[model samples]
Target: AQSVTQPDIHITVSEGASLELRCNYSYGATPYLFWYVQSPGQGLQLLLKYFSGDTLVQGIKGFEAEFKRSQSSFNLRKPSVHWSDAAEYFCAVGHGSGNTGKLIFGQGTTLQVKP
Candidate 1:
Protein backbone atom coordinates (compact mmCIF):
# COMPACT_ATOMS: atom_id res chain seq x y z
CA ALA A 1 0.00 0.00 0.00
CA GLN A 2 2.26 2.74 -1.25
CA SER A 3 0.36 5.93 -1.95
CA VAL A 4 -0.24 9.52 -0.93
CA THR A 5 -3.58 10.89 0.19
CA GLN A 6 -4.73 14.45 0.72
CA PRO A 7 -7.90 14.53 2.77
CA ASP A 8 -8.93 18.05 1.82
CA ILE A 9 -10.13 18.37 -1.73
CA HIS A 10 -10.43 22.10 -1.41
CA ILE A 11 -10.00 24.79 1.22
CA THR A 12 -11.12 28.42 1.46
CA VAL A 13 -9.87 31.00 3.89
CA SER A 14 -9.93 34.75 4.38
CA GLU A 15 -6.78 36.76 3.99
CA GLY A 16 -4.39 36.69 6.92
CA ALA A 17 -5.88 33.54 8.35
CA SER A 18 -4.28 30.32 9.42
CA LEU A 19 -4.11 27.33 7.11
CA GLU A 20 -3.50 23.60 7.28
CA LEU A 21 -3.55 20.93 4.56
CA ARG A 22 -3.70 17.33 5.60
CA CYS A 23 -1.55 14.63 4.02
CA ASN A 24 -1.09 10.97 4.82
CA TYR A 25 1.16 8.40 3.18
CA SER A 26 1.51 4.65 3.13
CA TYR A 27 5.02 3.43 2.45
CA GLY A 28 7.79 1.27 3.77
CA ALA A 29 11.36 2.42 4.44
CA THR A 30 12.19 6.11 4.90
CA PRO A 31 9.48 8.08 3.17
CA TYR A 32 10.42 11.21 1.27
CA LEU A 33 7.61 13.64 1.94
CA PHE A 34 7.06 16.66 -0.30
CA TRP A 35 4.63 19.56 -0.66
CA TYR A 36 4.19 21.50 -3.86
CA VAL A 37 2.14 24.46 -5.04
CA GLN A 38 1.01 25.25 -8.56
CA SER A 39 -0.33 28.42 -10.02
CA PRO A 40 -2.17 29.07 -13.25
CA GLY A 41 -0.13 28.00 -16.28
CA GLN A 42 2.85 27.42 -14.00
CA GLY A 43 4.70 24.28 -13.06
CA LEU A 44 4.68 22.80 -9.59
CA GLN A 45 7.03 24.40 -7.12
CA LEU A 46 8.58 22.52 -4.25
CA LEU A 47 7.31 23.91 -1.01
CA LEU A 48 9.24 21.58 1.21
CA LYS A 49 10.42 18.05 1.75
CA TYR A 50 11.07 15.59 4.59
CA PHE A 51 13.87 13.15 3.93
CA SER A 52 15.59 12.47 7.23
CA GLY A 53 16.72 14.09 10.42
CA ASP A 54 14.28 16.46 12.08
CA THR A 55 10.69 15.32 12.25
CA LEU A 56 9.53 18.90 11.90
CA VAL A 57 10.61 20.32 8.55
CA GLN A 58 10.51 23.91 7.35
CA GLY A 59 9.73 24.91 3.78
CA ILE A 60 9.79 27.87 1.51
CA LYS A 61 7.05 30.53 1.18
CA GLY A 62 6.58 30.66 4.92
CA PHE A 63 5.32 27.10 5.18
CA GLU A 64 6.10 24.19 7.47
CA ALA A 65 5.22 20.55 7.99
CA GLU A 66 5.59 17.89 10.65
CA PHE A 67 6.12 14.20 10.00
CA LYS A 68 4.26 12.03 12.48
CA ARG A 69 5.28 8.43 12.19
CA SER A 70 2.73 7.27 14.75
CA GLN A 71 -0.08 8.83 12.79
CA SER A 72 1.59 8.12 9.45
CA SER A 73 0.86 11.68 8.43
CA PHE A 74 2.69 14.72 7.14
CA ASN A 75 0.50 17.78 7.34
CA LEU A 76 1.31 21.20 5.89
CA ARG A 77 0.52 24.32 7.87
CA LYS A 78 0.97 28.04 7.56
CA PRO A 79 0.72 30.64 10.28
CA SER A 80 -1.03 33.11 8.00
CA VAL A 81 -2.75 32.71 4.69
CA HIS A 82 -2.10 35.39 2.13
CA TRP A 83 -4.09 36.08 -1.00
CA SER A 84 -1.23 34.80 -3.11
CA ASP A 85 -1.43 31.53 -1.27
CA ALA A 86 -4.60 30.75 -3.13
CA ALA A 87 -3.62 27.95 -5.47
CA GLU A 88 -3.56 24.22 -5.92
CA TYR A 89 -1.55 22.26 -3.38
CA PHE A 90 -0.46 18.68 -3.74
CA CYS A 91 1.29 16.23 -1.45
CA ALA A 92 3.69 13.81 -3.09
CA VAL A 93 6.26 11.22 -2.07
CA GLY A 94 9.46 9.83 -3.66
CA HIS A 95 12.81 11.00 -4.94
CA GLY A 96 12.72 10.40 -8.70
CA SER A 97 10.06 10.57 -11.37
CA GLY A 98 10.52 7.43 -13.48
CA ASN A 99 9.35 5.09 -10.71
CA THR A 100 11.29 6.25 -7.74
CA GLY A 101 9.74 9.74 -7.63
CA LYS A 102 6.83 7.75 -9.04
CA LEU A 103 4.58 9.98 -6.92
CA ILE A 104 0.97 9.24 -6.20
CA PHE A 105 -0.87 12.57 -6.16
CA GLY A 106 -3.83 12.83 -3.80
CA GLN A 107 -6.46 14.11 -6.18
CA GLY A 108 -5.43 17.68 -5.29
CA THR A 109 -6.51 20.40 -2.90
CA THR A 110 -7.57 23.80 -4.20
CA LEU A 111 -7.08 26.70 -1.83
CA GLN A 112 -9.24 29.75 -2.33
CA VAL A 113 -8.50 33.06 -0.68
CA LYS A 114 -10.90 35.88 0.06
CA PRO A 115 -9.83 39.47 0.35
Candidate 2:
Protein backbone atom coordinates (compact mmCIF):
# COMPACT_ATOMS: atom_id res chain seq x y z
CA ALA A 1 0.00 0.00 0.00
CA GLN A 2 1.12 3.54 -0.79
CA SER A 3 -0.12 6.81 0.60
CA VAL A 4 0.93 10.47 0.60
CA THR A 5 0.30 13.06 3.25
CA GLN A 6 0.86 16.77 3.66
CA PRO A 7 1.05 17.36 7.37
CA ASP A 8 0.14 21.00 7.07
CA ILE A 9 -3.30 21.59 5.62
CA HIS A 10 -2.76 25.33 5.55
CA ILE A 11 0.12 27.75 5.96
CA THR A 12 0.23 31.51 6.22
CA VAL A 13 3.22 33.78 5.96
CA SER A 14 4.11 37.37 5.34
CA GLU A 15 5.80 38.35 2.11
CA GLY A 16 9.61 38.06 2.05
CA ALA A 17 9.62 35.44 4.81
CA SER A 18 10.83 31.92 4.24
CA LEU A 19 8.40 29.08 3.60
CA GLU A 20 8.26 25.39 4.17
CA LEU A 21 5.68 22.75 3.27
CA ARG A 22 5.83 19.39 4.93
CA CYS A 23 5.09 16.16 3.12
CA ASN A 24 5.21 12.58 4.30
CA TYR A 25 4.50 9.26 2.62
CA SER A 26 4.07 5.57 3.26
CA TYR A 27 4.85 3.03 0.56
CA GLY A 28 5.47 -0.67 0.60
CA ALA A 29 8.23 -0.18 -1.95
CA THR A 30 10.36 2.72 -3.10
CA PRO A 31 7.83 5.15 -4.52
CA TYR A 32 7.90 7.56 -7.41
CA LEU A 33 7.63 11.05 -5.96
CA PHE A 34 6.33 14.36 -7.19
CA TRP A 35 5.38 17.86 -6.13
CA TYR A 36 2.92 20.04 -7.97
CA VAL A 37 1.46 23.49 -7.49
CA GLN A 38 -1.99 24.60 -8.49
CA SER A 39 -3.42 28.06 -8.73
CA PRO A 40 -7.11 28.72 -8.31
CA GLY A 41 -9.15 26.66 -10.77
CA GLN A 42 -6.05 25.76 -12.74
CA GLY A 43 -4.22 22.56 -13.56
CA LEU A 44 -1.31 21.37 -11.53
CA GLN A 45 2.22 22.30 -12.61
CA LEU A 46 4.96 19.85 -11.78
CA LEU A 47 7.50 21.30 -9.45
CA LEU A 48 9.88 18.39 -9.10
CA LYS A 49 10.18 14.64 -8.69
CA TYR A 50 12.45 12.11 -7.03
CA PHE A 51 12.56 8.58 -8.37
CA SER A 52 16.00 7.47 -7.30
CA GLY A 53 19.36 8.82 -6.28
CA ASP A 54 20.19 12.40 -5.29
CA THR A 55 18.00 12.78 -2.26
CA LEU A 56 18.03 16.53 -2.68
CA VAL A 57 16.18 17.87 -5.69
CA GLN A 58 15.85 21.38 -7.05
CA GLY A 59 12.69 22.68 -8.61
CA ILE A 60 11.35 25.60 -10.54
CA LYS A 61 10.28 28.88 -8.91
CA GLY A 62 13.21 28.86 -6.50
CA PHE A 63 11.98 25.77 -4.68
CA GLU A 64 13.83 22.71 -3.47
CA ALA A 65 13.28 19.57 -1.44
CA GLU A 66 15.16 16.81 0.23
CA PHE A 67 14.04 13.21 0.05
CA LYS A 68 14.65 11.19 3.21
CA ARG A 69 14.16 7.50 2.71
CA SER A 70 14.33 6.71 6.38
CA GLN A 71 11.98 9.50 7.32
CA SER A 72 9.73 8.90 4.32
CA SER A 73 9.47 12.58 3.72
CA PHE A 74 9.96 15.11 0.93
CA ASN A 75 9.66 18.60 2.30
CA LEU A 76 9.51 21.68 0.09
CA ARG A 77 11.27 24.86 1.07
CA LYS A 78 11.82 28.35 -0.21
CA PRO A 79 14.20 30.91 1.21
CA SER A 80 11.73 33.73 0.62
CA VAL A 81 8.03 33.95 0.09
CA HIS A 82 6.02 36.11 -2.24
CA TRP A 83 2.37 37.00 -2.59
CA SER A 84 2.29 35.31 -5.97
CA ASP A 85 3.51 32.12 -4.35
CA ALA A 86 0.25 31.89 -2.47
CA ALA A 87 -1.58 28.88 -3.80
CA GLU A 88 -2.37 25.24 -3.17
CA TYR A 89 0.46 22.74 -3.00
CA PHE A 90 0.22 19.01 -3.36
CA CYS A 91 2.56 16.11 -2.73
CA ALA A 92 2.06 12.83 -4.53
CA VAL A 93 3.35 9.29 -4.95
CA GLY A 94 3.07 7.19 -8.07
CA HIS A 95 3.38 3.42 -8.10
CA GLY A 96 2.11 2.96 -11.58
CA SER A 97 2.69 -0.53 -12.83
CA GLY A 98 0.87 -0.34 -16.13
CA ASN A 99 -1.24 2.75 -15.99
CA THR A 100 -0.07 5.98 -17.53
CA GLY A 101 -0.31 8.03 -14.34
CA LYS A 102 -1.69 7.00 -11.01
CA LEU A 103 -0.88 9.54 -8.37
CA ILE A 104 -2.17 9.50 -4.82
CA PHE A 105 -2.23 13.11 -3.67
CA GLY A 106 -2.30 14.77 -0.32
CA GLN A 107 -5.55 16.53 0.55
CA GLY A 108 -3.83 19.87 -0.23
CA THR A 109 -2.27 22.78 1.59
CA THR A 110 -3.56 26.27 1.10
CA LEU A 111 -1.19 29.20 1.50
CA GLN A 112 -2.27 32.57 2.74
CA VAL A 113 -0.12 35.49 1.68
CA LYS A 114 0.10 38.64 3.76
CA PRO A 115 1.42 41.56 1.83
Badly placed stretches (over 4 Å) of model 2 are 96-100
True-vs-predicted CA distance for residue 52, candidate 1, Å: 0.7
Query: lDDT at 70 for candidate 2?
Result: 90
Poorest stretch of ten by lDDT in candidate 1: 95-104
TM-score of each: 0.91, 0.93
lDDT of each: 0.89, 0.90
Write model 2 residue lDDT over 1-115, tens digit each, in one string: 6778898898999999999899999988778889999999999999999888999899999999899989999999999998999999999998757546788999889998899
The segments of candidate 1 whose C-alpha lies over 4 angstroms from its true place after superposition are 95-99
Cα displacement (angstroms), candidate 1, residue 104, comes to 2.5
**Which predicted model would earn the best TM-score?**
2
lDDT of 1 by residue, 13-33 (tens): 999999999999887766788
Clashes of each: 1, 0
